[model samples]
Target: SRSLFVKNLNFRTSDENLKKHFTEKLNEGRVQSAKVKKHLKNGKNVSMGFGFIELDSVETATKVCKDLQGTILDGHALILQHCHAKSDDKVSNRADKDKSSTKLIVRNVAFEATEKDLRQLFSPFGQVKSLRLPMKLGNHRGFAFVEFVTKQEAQNALQQLSSVHLYGRHLVLERAKEGETLEDLRARTAAQFTDEQNGYQNSTKLAKKRKHMDILDKPDVMFEKIAR
Candidate 1:
């Protein structure tokens, strides 16, 4: 297939921008078609932060994926992969189901880490299907979920980034369990912290930690209070 999957694009990147990047800026080859995927939300067209590009030939697509894999466009690094042509509907449905297993839970992320930072870190393995960093009070919660296009890519990232440090913090990467949610992760983290504090003799410190956990437990209510 001459088509390529482009991921981690800036939301503002348009279809013309994608075509120009490959054909004009890089001068690599002719782009047959370029499209930044979008959908209508509340009657507004919103970019999905990903796109597809079809080149003149498979070789051109391969070269583009190899050479411009991490090219930054509009402040976000791009992840490129040679995408296979779509199969029949049944196979496509199966692929969609398989995607659930490709998500990774990234713990111990630096609070200062941005989506761009993580995209750059993981782009080498494969196409990043999607990424989410839960936020609170204008900053991330020190964790993220990154879903790759393939389970092998997710596994590779897990093995490679386990020892890597960002902003002076070691990242802990693991395959996300099926049907897991952000609330589940928060509860698990709280449980781990509580277990670590089990033998502590300082009742005052324990009480303070428990109070903090209580605040975290009601995130929506806390956010509402802040809004008011």
Candidate 2:
């Protein structure tokens, strides 16, 4: 299942040229197919450096990536990866070709449910840390993803929620759409924390200094001003 994308390829390079390059470097007929993307603009075709190469197997793909990534190809380093699609969804919520979120799905709920409600219901089985409740036109769809503190919690919820009933509706919980890992969650949390910290550090220093002065009674009228 290792489909690779080669970036920074020569614009004029054809599938035959690319196949020859791979054959020289790897082995005979290792490449299944290779094609550069062409776009029609003003009735003229333009070649894009990016192209896909299907290898014989995942190991061969890895070998190609490890060997060719960062290697110079026509004045551009060849970047290779497992042909991940460009998506707006964060790494955790990536939508594959199927257009489904990588995160797990949770369904079958009472229309009045909230994230807090789901967490409470699932917390008994394990550490229910975070919950995302989906809404349509400002109405709860009766399903939510309860991210447990650990994968084991998620697995437990997958098993337990099927039998557990809340508000007369049986809860259905599954792994986050794409089986997102703890590292992805941590990275997201770290990014948010960095953003919040940067904003606070940049904008709050003067206000915080004024508040500190007021607390020390340096400006006695500051309290009155704040009260007013």
Candidate 3:
């Protein structure tokens, strides 16, 4: 295969680590080299969050790209595209990029479940970026947000969890909801603390969305909330 430019590598990663990771992805190639170039101004290393791999031929490279483009590696998307130039940076596509909004909403949880328990359940599907269980002081609300490394994995989790009962109750799983970006997830937690102190609820939409998603208005007890 023609030489490729693998950019966006982890700043702390070395050629050997990249080779091992690529070897796992290709499974047929010997990644000859995986070098991390130094920044020019102060010689500081910057993780461009990308990298390259050399295969025996163009056919192998194409096959590799086809297999791993949307996969997740090292808690980030393993972007595999034809290399154009050398520099470590992210992909130009929005779908391939991870922004502040990609996260999963896990509801109808057992009141006894802990943060560790939630992580253990979903970690098998993919790298969990974060697993947060809503707790007020020492109270468990039976709701959580388990953020997977990729959106596809999050969807997979929802499919597997829907209609499935844990602790004798059907678990509610779906996309966390719009307007609930990753940045504001924790913001609500902080705001909730203040609101609790002042004896009021935060104005964030998640609390209300959670209420609606649980289908609290439905009259039947046997009904399940379906994700759109």
Per-candidate clashes, comma-separated: 0, 7, 12
Question: lDDT tens string, model 2, 34-131?
Answer: 77655443466655455677888888887888777787656767676554322344432322232223334566767755666566555544555566
Q: After superposition, how far is residue 115 of candidate 1 from its true place, in Å?
A: 1.1
Which segments of model 1 are wrong by more than 4 Å? 1-97, 181-228
Name the runs in model 3 displaced over 4 angstroms.
Answer: 1-95, 98-101, 183-228
Error of 2 at 170 (Å): 47
Give the per-residue lDDT of model 3 (tens digit) for 5-95: 4443444666677677767767675556665433322354444344456667776776766776655555555545454222233332331
lDDT of model 2, residue 9: 72
Query: How would you encode candidate 1's per-residue C-alpha lDDT over 1-228 as one tens digit per residue?
Result: 687778777879999998888887556567899997665455777676777888898888888888888998889988876554334776555546776667888888877678987887777566888888877789887778788876666766676455556655678887777766546655665566466567465776889999899889999898999999
| Structural similarity to truth (TM-score) of each candidate | 0.43, 0.37, 0.39
Inter-residue clash pairs, candidate 1: none
Q: Report RMSD for candidate 1.
A: 13.4
Best by TM-score: 1
